[model samples]
Target chain A: MTAAALEAARVWLVVALTLLGLFFSFVSMVGVLRLPDLYSRAHTASQADTLGAGFGLAAVALTVGLAGAGFKSVLLLFFIFVTNPTAAHAIARAAFEEGIVPWTNGDERR
Target chain B: MADADPPPGDGASADGPVDSAETSGPSAEASDADATSGPTTSGPTTSGPTTSGPTATAGAIIVPVEPTSTLRSTIAHVAEAAANDGAPALHLVEIASWRDGDPESDERAAAAERVLERVAAWATADLDDSEAPAAADVEVVTAVIGADDYLFGADDYVRVLAEYAEENAADRVVLDPEYTPVGNTTLLQPLEFALSNTSLSVETAPVDRPTRRERFRTEATTGRFVALFGLSLAFYLLLGDPTYWFDAVTGVATAAVVSITLSRVSLDSTPAIPRTPMRIARGLVYVPVLLYEILKANLVVARVILDPRLPIEPTLNRMRVIVGSGLPLMTLANSITLTPGTLTVRARDSDLYVHSLVPWAREGLFDGSLERWTRFVYYGRRSARLPTPRERDDVAILQGDDATEELPIAAADGGAVGAGDESDGGDETDAAESIDDEVTDR
Candidate 1:
């Protein structure tokens, strides 16, 4: 491939990753607002948001091209992957322990 | 796949290395070879015929045998009890599960026998090790139960054990804290619960377990230290400009300090060539599969939340998984939580309490795809293709329409929280704020 074509491909990849990240983040926001109960809200908060962060960080890594900033972004992605689910677990565990009954089909939205 | 599945052997599967019997404490480690060679008990009763019948008196103490790190400690504890209470016979029982007329029945029986005999010898040794010459008088009898039966659930194992206890007139049961009759499945909770329903007085041996922090303190080898040092220096240089002399000098200093302080603490195991690299490669392969699932589930959950009716059938389900504990368990738990529509509320032993937003997600969780993937990552592909939780009848809906809800808050908490009592004023707004913080902070 030509240098210009390769550059264009890189640009396209970064853009695609960025858009996907934004889309996931938007879904997470909607789910947070629309979902019933603390437990369900936590699902979106941990899963969708973390995925969004992953894609966004990937885009940043690609833009920086495996250099100083790129490596740091990758590290940040790893930490987010580790911590996000754990934070969600902590929240869900606390709710369950506190007797916050999860919302079911018949129950009214909390 | 469920029926065609071979009967689980005696820790001979791909997960053999991680099995508590093979890898745990010094007691379990010391008996590894001796167990395979067959029973080496000096106790007269232990050497007797398998069908010698229950000669145990009412003072007989029953200790369920498993090659756990706490096995020796449990034996020592039982010996001390025997010394104090004047118990005549100490029964070492190992439950072996096999489908009636299954081809693997003999293998299962022989494995169970080996475990039982090994434990009997350990008990005898513990007694002999003690200063009391009277300790040698405690008869150790070994029995392999449930070999002829298709023992499926925790209740089945409990039934066989209770029957043995009753026949032997053994009132007291001393449990090794690490005992799990069915491999990798956490039956201690349900086993204890079911046994409690019977006349058996069950108590876990009061052996000291390594605390979470203490788990980090494995033997610090030079290979581990060097690996950690190199990793730290690379990470440091990656963040800063490696070409700069100042960064290089500071990175070296920082890496040295980190390797010195946290080298042993950070890595779960010593980094071995081929194994470590192969695991990393497999883990990398797992990332795409996980990301694909996350995306697919995210779209599905997004549609549900975006719908006008907001179609969701939230339920809490408890699934007993056989992916071995520690890092693999954490991986499965985290992977479950990171997938949309399923949130892992709590993980106790091998049982994970997951909250699913819809039936689709609940079914997926029971299907055990992620669990199989986790097993594949840690224990290889052969161990990956086990029966799903649904097939194994190891899942229970803890809440919603189909749920029995018989397990109260205390049972669910593993006795950590209040007993069957609901804490008033849960404060929903606080929880919502935490969720908000979690999202925005990320």
Candidate 2:
């Protein structure tokens, strides 16, 4: 393919990935506030935060085309993907063990 | 006082005249009458005649009457009358009596004096008329005993107080409840038990709350955060290169500072971390000993292999060692297996079950000198003297029996006969005889 066409395809891919990342990021914030309790909120934060932040970082790295920064960004994403869920699970388990019962809608404190 | 109110003439009247048996001095009754009749404004019942009118109109005025006679009936009547009037007063009377001139009596008197002072302070503070003027009256009396005379056993003090309450037409005995004197004399428990069982109410002065400085002193340490940071830094440096070390150090420092600052802000102080230098030293020493034992066992196994006839008598024997920690028990077991002639079949608490290949090795199990040396090496000699084999065996039988029982069953189930199994019946007889000999030796 010609250089101009290749450049156009790369730019389109970056734009598409950025929009996808923005969507996930919005979903993560919404889930954080809207989820019923801490456990569910934790699940949303761990999964959506890791994935959205990872995709956004990847898109930014692709758009900039800086090798070292891209590599570091990927490493950060890997770290978040691995650690976030484990930490969230540990916190939820500890809260459960300590007898923190979840609140239901009807029973919410006014 | 108008006319010296003639002393109630019945000496045997209930409430028995406060013991005048010792000093032949003025009795508590006489002293109380003097104190009450003295124009002092401190009389608990008649603080003011003006206030008494409203209180009397509400109910019969339950004046704290002085003990008049030595009759149980009179005391009961007074108590019942006071209860009916809904006002009761404590009467403090001083009785001077003498027990024998023992120094213990003086000590007890001194202790009782301290208790009385505390009671007096409590009464002054606790019974402020502003709070509950209609409640029972409280009067305090001091009594002195002669050197040759004993008042009553300390155990009877509570009973005496209760009886005094009844005689004074009081619902509760109001004395300083300082229990230190009773505790020092080992009489507090019985006194408290007796008081708890009684119908009349008993109350103690509230303990003062801790001061601000005390709370501050309890909460001013950040040692744990510092130690945790130090540990993490040390671990990072030992395991990582320069960049990793730098990252770890920064992360740990940040965490420590954040934690310490949060604790300060929240007023939640960290607890002191116990120093375990001896335990660290033990772990350091044991790691090397275990390595050496592993090497030595390798040599012994090699030696056993070279001997063609393979003179081996496999037997299970128990060894006792004085070890307090679980780590040492693990060390001992691993050390045994590292040696050629023995393998640790079971270990629990302080007892070890070792299967030995040679009879001499079995003999070594019962040797007290070896056990003592093991103790000296593992635990410092200053800690405790090594226990004898008999003591070891007794402890083992008591605590290690369950672990020991598992060994024979394991051996039976595995059915992996040793090299000596070649001679069949002869080997079995010999093995049995050897075990019998070992038991008799013990």
Candidate 3:
């Protein structure tokens, strides 16, 4: 393929990845609002955030090329992947101990 | 008044209603159902063997008690057998003749032995039918001795038993009520006290199982795998923004450096404390409320400044805070300080001194929106008992002696007020005015 075509393809890939990232991020926010219990909400938020962040970073990397910006983006993605879930897990564990009950339809325990 | 009953075996159910040995069958089922449904009731009737046969009869075969050392292993075997029969285990520690030698040495050893045996037996029994039941275990420890040797009071024995039950997660203790009246009275009272005080699932003779809720609450949550996967995904999404990620990382690194430098400069450096889950929970609740309060305060402060009449009633007031942690208290103080017309001058345990632009703010000091907001934010639910204004005595104002107070008068020379001077009251009003001015300035 020509250099122009290659550049165009990379742009398209970035666009696609960006859209995927947006989709996951929206889903994560929805999960936070929708899930009944702190534990379940935490589960949804953590998973969606990680996947969305990963895809978003990949898109940025593709758009910027394999240089300074791209490397930094990848590093951010790695940190988020490791720390976000860890923080979520800690919060969930604490909530569980504090006796936060999971939401169930028709249950008014909360 | 009745003849003392024999010690029930591990097979006996302790939770059922007390009935004559003749009516044991029906009462046993009734008691079991009762225990399964609600809190188990403990009474003298539930303390003895349910059967009136040779096993229940007084002076019936009292097995030669083994040495205290071998008691735990023996109880383990008995518990094993009892579990096989779907029964709660029984552990008997006879503290009859504990003070045989010199009052000090012999009695202490005997007391120690009694405590150890009860503890071991209780632990072994709890392990027997646990969810992941340890190897079926029973412990029957009998400390046979003359009447005078029972040196330690029953209360001490109960205390030891309770500690053991908590440590070993034992459900119940079975004591033989066949001893002398004094011994029986002392033992029963303390046993009841221990059973009530500790978190153990206790049952007296005959042995019975605990309720289903007790069992369910103790079980670990089942969906950890799904939770782990979901969390992983969220992390990946957050990392997508390279700029934000780098900024946060750099921020954290800078914070660490600052912390280290501060530590080196002074022996009592501010530590870099991670936000605890409880604090985060409180923050989630408080941030929104704080924003609303700030908005309200800003509006009030603006009205006071803009109106030529300057309907301001500046006053210093102290408020009491009920939260326990330093971080939450700091958050509360900072939040108050951040809002217009209110500045936190001092904060001590359960008390805060605030300087308000309006005197009405004092009315709300302990009874107003901020106090209510603090309580709701700190404790997810409201309690009937709210802290009183008297509690405010503890908090004091650091500033607001009229020396630090600055009015909104512009300098007579027409020069702009210094930033330091403006900050007292003029700066905050100016900031608010500028934001509003920008909307108008636009």
Candidate 4:
């Protein structure tokens, strides 16, 4: 592809990934609010949040174009991917240990 | 918490309350309980179940049944107390999480029955052996409660047990020291606290608990040390400039310190040369599959959350996995949690207690796609192609009964059917055994 075409494609890729990131983050927020208990809340807090962060980081990394900062962003993405679910697990486990029953269909929203 | 071995060890130790009795005493029990701090205090602060002499008169002692080593001792302790009270009814209750009409309800109920049966037999045996032969008549009533309800937290458990205790006119509740209904996550504190709010006095049976240190790997291998040193050095250099003399010096120093301190504990096992690199490459292949799953499930969960109707079923199910233990199990558990709509609530022995948000998610979990992938990652293609959890009869809905897929009694005997030991135990399953051998061969 030509230089102008390549640059345009890169910009579009960044925009799309950033938008996707924002969308997932918005969903995570809604999920945390709407989901009934700690266990369910963690589903969004970990998975949704990590995906959101992941897409956002990917966009940033692409925009920076494979240099030092880009590598750092990728590393940050890796850390978030590894740590996010673990944090959620710890929180859910704490809640479980505390004797907080998970909310099911019939139970009142907490 | 990330490790998979603690639960089984904890469960195994907790299940043998009989052994705990021999090891039990005021000094040993006190210091040990002090480390945990919650369950021990909650018990004695109330109507003084373990303190203030033997004639405390427990009208009915409700003991939540789990397969902990402390359970045998807890039963013996309760039986002794019951004997002192002169024929107080001993209620053995297993809190189940099931709706009235789940397809697996019968299987779940049968599992609960087996646990109760074993515990009741132990209780009867203990009573028979008691100094007070008159206490041999101690009525042992076992029932599975929470059958119709969705029990999620300590309050729910307390609510059900309180209702059961009230029905039986039980005044005291004796819990096994390691009575973590939801696997290794210790629920004793919250259960005790919640139960304290009720009329029934709560007490964690003063049994000898295995020290937390014993649960961890302590032996440092040369292979593990070298592997950790190499990885640490790589990580350090990656963060800093590889060409810088300062960075190289500091990196080596840091790597040495890390390897020296954590070589034994960090990695699950010693890294084999070509095998480790091969596994890493295969593991890299798994990332796309995992990411795809995450993306798809995220959309589904997001849609459900966004929908006005808010369609969510939120069921806890159990699946016995054969991804071996330690790092492999941690990988599977974390992957399950990372996938939206399903959260791994606990990992006790080979069983994963997963909470599924919707029917779609629950169905996905039962499908064992991720589990199969996990096996493929850890054990290889042949192991991955084995029967799905549903097909293998290793999956169950733990909602109603304390979903011990196999009885904890069997688990305590070191015969908990997992990986190699399929419950069916005959015929074509030699295929599974040979595969298990293949996995261990690594």
lDDT of 2 by residue, A1-110 (tens): 69999999889988888886776566556645654455435434543444467568878888877554665676676566445534654565455445444333333432
Whole-model lDDT, model 3: 0.42
* DockQ for every prediction shown: 0.57, 0.01, 0.02, 0.27
Residue-level lDDT of model 4, residues A21-52, one tens digit each, is 99999989988898888888888887556689
Q: Please give the lDDT score at residue A107 for candidate 2.
A: 38
Report candidate 2's fraction of native contacts: 0.00
| Candidate of highest TM-score | 1
Q: Give the TM-score of candidate 1.
A: 0.64
The weakest ten consecutive residues by lDDT in model 3 chain B span: B55-64
Better of 1 and 3 by TM-score: 1
Per-candidate chain B TM: 0.54, 0.33, 0.30, 0.44
lDDT per residue (tens digit) for residues B188-292 in model 1: 888888778788888998877542222212333577898899999998888788899999999999999999998756765567775677667888889989989
TM-score of each: 0.64, 0.29, 0.27, 0.54
- Shift in Å, residue B372, candidate 1: 2.0
Higher DockQ: candidate 1 or 3? 1
* Model 1 error, position B371 (Å): 2.1
Better of 2 and 3 by TM-score: 2
Error (Å) of candidate 4 at residue B193 is: 24
- Location of the lowest summed lDDT over 10 successive residues in candidate 1 chain A: A43-52
In model 3, how large is the Cα lDDT of residue B413? 35
What DockQ does candidate 1 have relative to the true complex? 0.57
